[model samples]
Target: MATGKKAKNVGKGMKGKVKETTGKAVGNESMEMKGKAEQAAADAKQAGQKAKDTMKH
Candidate 1:
């Protein structure tokens, strides 16, 4: 089972993906780029957290 923090990060990443897709579908370039950036950041954060947790073991 995934921890609560991991689940939350995954949810956030999904939300970013939805925003990005919606923005692109609506032809809003700015919003689409923003969403994409947010998604990348969220992914990086999640990865970092996972690395940190692994080091604790």
Candidate 2:
């Protein structure tokens, strides 16, 4: 289900944001970078889904 996938991705993005913030607060560069990458991947997936939905209509 597209809706379910979209909601999951949104949650992933929010989680990534939290990870990135916490890493920064703790001075952990690796965790920060990983979080950033996760956010980027989630964003890309969301964009792809949006395009697919647009095409469907």
Candidate number of the best lDDT: 2
Clash count of each predicted structure: 0, 0
In model 2, state the lDDT of residue 54.
92
lDDT per model, in order? 0.85, 0.90
List the RMSD of every prediction in angstroms. Answer: 1.8, 1.2
What are the models' TM-scores?
0.86, 0.93
User: Which candidate has the highest TM-score of all?
Assistant: 2
lDDT (tens digit, per residue) of candidate 1 on 1-57 = 248878888888888898899999999998888888878888988998988988888
Worst lDDT 10-window in candidate 2: 1-10
Q: Tell me the TM-score of model 1.
A: 0.86
Residue 32 displacement (Å), model 2: 0.5
Off by over 4 Å in 1: none
